[model samples]
Target: MMHTSVGWHVEMEFREDDQHTRAVAMVRLPDGSEVRAHGHASRHQTDVNQPRVGEEIAAARALNELAMQLLTKAHGEIDQASGRTSHPIHV
Candidate 1:
């Protein structure tokens, strides 16, 4: 029997404007495929001006979206391997 271990590196970037913060998350797989997702957070009139909070929220949302996309891709691959039509699989 044999075992193998694999790893991937994920990166994230954040940008901010006067009223909004944007985040992008990216992952590059060993097979040269890349997955990326974006998320944003907006400041309201009543909200306190907090840059760190905005960055945290935006980055978390972007990572969440990225995770969902990766799960969807995995589900599609599984369906193809099993000779079945791809179906929406909620995570």
Candidate 2:
């Protein structure tokens, strides 16, 4: 059995206000490239105050965007090396 492990570290930052939350997520690839994505959440005027919920929503959106970006990057790299366009499966 192979005992080797690989890891990646992602960083996220948030800027929040009473009615809004914005998040940015970033990760550095082993090839020395950095990818970043942003997300935002806004509370409705009638919504109750919930900072934690806002943070969670914003963070999840940011992470989702980051994942999409990474997939796009990898897909481009594959196309470049393979010399053919490959269709992507929708998630």
Candidate 3:
């Protein structure tokens, strides 16, 4: 049996104000490539102020986008290696 171990670390940063929250999510691949995604959340005029909720929403969106990007990248690589179009990859 052959065994291999790999690990990836993701970094997330957020910026928030009274009405808006912005988040950036990044991951560094083993092949010396970096992928990043951004997300934003806006507070409604009548909504309660909850910084944590805003941050969570923004971060989740950013991470979701990042996952989609990674999947797309893998799909492209698979197609390139196989020399044919592959099935669609979804989040």
Candidate 4:
């Protein structure tokens, strides 16, 4: 498993399998904002109905990227609504 962060936060996992692999991403913003995303992909030698571990990772990365983009947009909206200075907060 690996942890990644952009405007939001993301997590990905890899497993050994000939079938499809699964991945998930999550994001939390200020003021208790939260969102989640997921992806799955098939691998070589695996049925199209199933995804490989690498494919799963790739899907997860894509989902995370989307989450980050959403967070970035939402963050801007939140800051604008609250009229708060742009600064990273520890939570």
- Most accurate candidate by lDDT: 3
Candidate 4 displacement at residue 59 in angstroms: 4.5
lDDT per residue (tens digit) for residues 1-91 in model 3: 9999999999999999999999999999999999999989999989999999999999999999999899889989999999998887563
Q: Please tell me which predicted candidate would have the highest TM-score against the true structure.
A: 3
List TM-score per model, in order.
0.85, 0.92, 0.93, 0.44
lDDT of 3 at 82: 98
Which of 3 and 4 is ahead in TM-score? 3
Q: Kindly list the per-residue Cα lDDT of model 4 for residues 8-60, writing each as its tens digit.
A: 44555544356556565655665575566566655656335444446656665
Better of 1 and 3 by TM-score: 3
Q: CA lDDT of each candidate?
A: 0.91, 0.92, 0.94, 0.60
RMSD of 2: 1.5
Question: Could you tell me which 10 consecutive residues in candidate 1 have the lowest summed lDDT?
Answer: 82-91
Candidate 4, 25: how far from true, in Å?
A: 0.4
TM-score, predicted candidate 3 vs. hidden true structure = 0.93
Instruction: Write one digit per residue (lDDT tens) for candidate 1, span 1-91.
Output: 9999999888989999878999999999887999999989999969889988899899999999999999888888988899987777665
User: RMSD, model 1, all Cα superposed?
Assistant: 1.7
* Candidate rank order under TM-score: 3, 2, 1, 4
The RMSD of every model to the true structure, in order and in angstroms, is: 1.7, 1.5, 1.1, 9.3
Query: Candidate 2 lDDT (Cα, whole model)?
Result: 0.92
Looking at model 3, the pairs that clash are: none
